[model samples]
Target: MFRNFGKRTEKAPDADTVVPLWPQNGSAAEAEPSAEDRKLSAFLELKSRMHEALIERLNLAVIDKVEPEELRREVASLVGDVLAEENNPLRADEFRRLVDELIDEVLGLGPLEPLLADPGVNDILVNGHKTVFVERAGVLEQTGVRFRDEKHLLRIIDKVVSRVGRRVDESNPWVDARLEDGSRVNAIIRPCAIDGPSLSIRKFSRDPLTLEKLVAGYALNAQAAAFLQALVEARMNILISGGTGSGKTTMLNAISASIDPRSRIVTIEDAAELQLQQAHVVRLETRPPNPAGGGAVSQRDLVRNALRMRPDRIIVGEVRGAESFDMLQAMNTGHDGSMTTVHANSARDALGRIEQMVSMIGMELPLPAIRAQIASGLQIIVQLARLADGQRRVVSISELTGLEGDVITMQDIFIFRRLGKAADGSIAGEFIPTGIRPQCTALLEAAGARFDRAMFLPEEA
Candidate 1:
């Protein structure tokens, strides 16, 4: 079922013919390329040639029908024969690395395969073909990974978007897609990018962190974790607010574990990143307009549709635009256990942003009316922040105490007080209760949730 698969006769560059891995565009300010960098660039070039030869020898029509393992063995066999014909001297480890990377080039995300496999790498930021950075343990560090050239980088980006039924080109220069493993990806090319193609991938973890794990990591104290779990068990409407990379999504995933397994849940998102572990759940993702600017489904549309799906809980991955209005309506009408995240600096700011988003729907509603909707719908606002030291912690958990006249009033049930910085540049903070008993305590108790009055008491200094 293959074409004439035989040894490649093309001459390969001698192992000693390594060239400097200078910036392809010849940036003057970049440091002198190192010997190791030169070797890597040479290997990349060699791999590119080998890939072309392999494709020429294989039957492209039936390649997609082959099983992954069988295809890998066939590709490896062909690559080995080609390498032997070229007679380039390589150590066993280097030869194996070359073969593995070739497989990635053929089936995976090319240079990003290794990074995506790294569990510690939480985020991948590709500025262009040559510069790649990864966030490990909440800290950004540059990696030595590089693509062959701009064309190669564009090919990889196209491959990623096409797999998700999306496209990126001059007409549609930007697209949001996800990897097979559900990693969130956003790619923007030429013209709009100014420099070159830019891609950002937020890697999704297979085993999502639970509330117990977050508490162990000191993201929040045990008392606060217990309280949040109780809030979820009570089916309270929760709004998680945080800035970018502040662990808002992680917090949402962890808290969602408390949702009853019997409950019918519906989750909506633009790129579909929420990893809710419930058994009975339907996930809905918004679709961008096609190349002809038709058949686009917005988040607001999914939220409205989810309401009719008879869901016990509606979990919106985020409320960025007019969807916030429909989400609030869902929470107020009947979906009491609904939850969502928002981009904001504080809990109060989160409310203000939601009000603005709701007004954007052009309902022409009064400010107090909007505030009243928010006050009745949302019960808890959990604020998260990533400290300067790269520690993400819940800064506060405030409860909506209903609107006092036209103003929506809230009381902080728990807070993290930043005492000072340590000598090692680490942040020193205390997760302390604000000693305010939330108005929802009765509601939680009525729902048979464990309510600990002592956990809400302020600590004695």
Candidate 2:
């Protein structure tokens, strides 16, 4: 049943079927350029010219109103015509790459588009026009990505802030904004940024991490996760404390999933990054003052408003200022299941920070009064840390046992014991129970929650 067209033989591939002139990894890794490199360089030069010509041909002011697919097709047609007129020798793959880059340049953040799309990249740090760095798996690495010049970088920054209804100029040298996908961005330009404009993007995951994922990643042990769930379900106020980039928000999001869906939860934030999953929830974000220095809204204002909304639980993204006092008042006065995060190195430091922030509001409260409030309002403090090896883990979980002679007392219920660094450079640690049952066990039991006693027993070494 077989028909032979000819003898099967190997043949030299066509030019279009050959490997792309650009590197396979999308980075120019080689120090020396081959003959094909010259062709690639020439094509890049031509693409730059075509990019400028295409920009001039389109009315950018109205570009956002156009359908993306339609705009891409129109741009492709124009690019094809230009390619034909130039009569440059380009392989089919290279021609398609040129079109995609041109489209990104016109409609997106030019040099950052590809980086933003990469799922492996956790943070994008743009130091200036020529330098770009990315944090992958908590390790910072430089990339080959670059802009045409400083002006081009400035354009990209403006494009980002403008979409969020914010601005960055000589007068306003810095701005905080969020991308459509919810990545938190902070940009500081000239004057403030001595060298040049610097942008930091804390990339948000498309699918927020859940408690199970955090356990699977060895961020915490199963016992701790179960205990935390019980605490949330029992309406215990929790303060997630950690340093910058220490996964405090991530932990907050994971634990918030345990909140009762029927309860009305209100979340406040500076840039609005919390993704709470409860059915009945309201989100609020603080607003910066206008150019004339009016119409500003603070987290304290949002917190005050959230109180009147009859929220069963209040969640603040991070308490950086006097809002800490309002947040604690809410927690103490009937909002038993409230949760928030603070930047601190340990559970005790977290309490100190809250005290300092409370004093900032000029409440004129004595230190003992503030400590009493914190101890009575907050039941659990979950401390997180990013280890030297770039692994983020729940380093400690403590229970505030109330004030001991004017000093707030806390006992660790669970702790991470570091053995040392592993061969591959990862910090090796064991999340072990401290064998001390939380004083809130009676309160949780009164709320109809049950837990295994052995969960609090320390492991045998």
Best by lDDT: 1
Q: Which stretches of candidate 1 lie over 4 Å from their true place?
A: 1-35, 59-72, 87-89
Q: Please give, for residues 271-364, the per-residue lDDT of candidate 1 as tens digits.
A: 8788888889899998989878999999999999998999999999989999999998999898998999999999999999999999999979
Write candidate 2's Cα lDDT for 142-243 as tens digits.
Answer: 997777668878988999989878889988899999888778999999999998999999998888999999999999988899899999999999999999
Candidate 2 lDDT score relative to the true structure: 0.88
User: Cα deviation in Å at residue 220, candidate 1?
Assistant: 0.5
The per-candidate count of clashes, in order, stands at 0, 0
Q: Which ten contiguous residues of candidate 1 have the minimum total lDDT?
A: 1-10
Per-candidate TM vs. native?
Answer: 0.90, 0.88
Per-residue lDDT value at 204 in model 1: 84
Off by over 4 Å in 2: 1-48, 56-70, 86-89
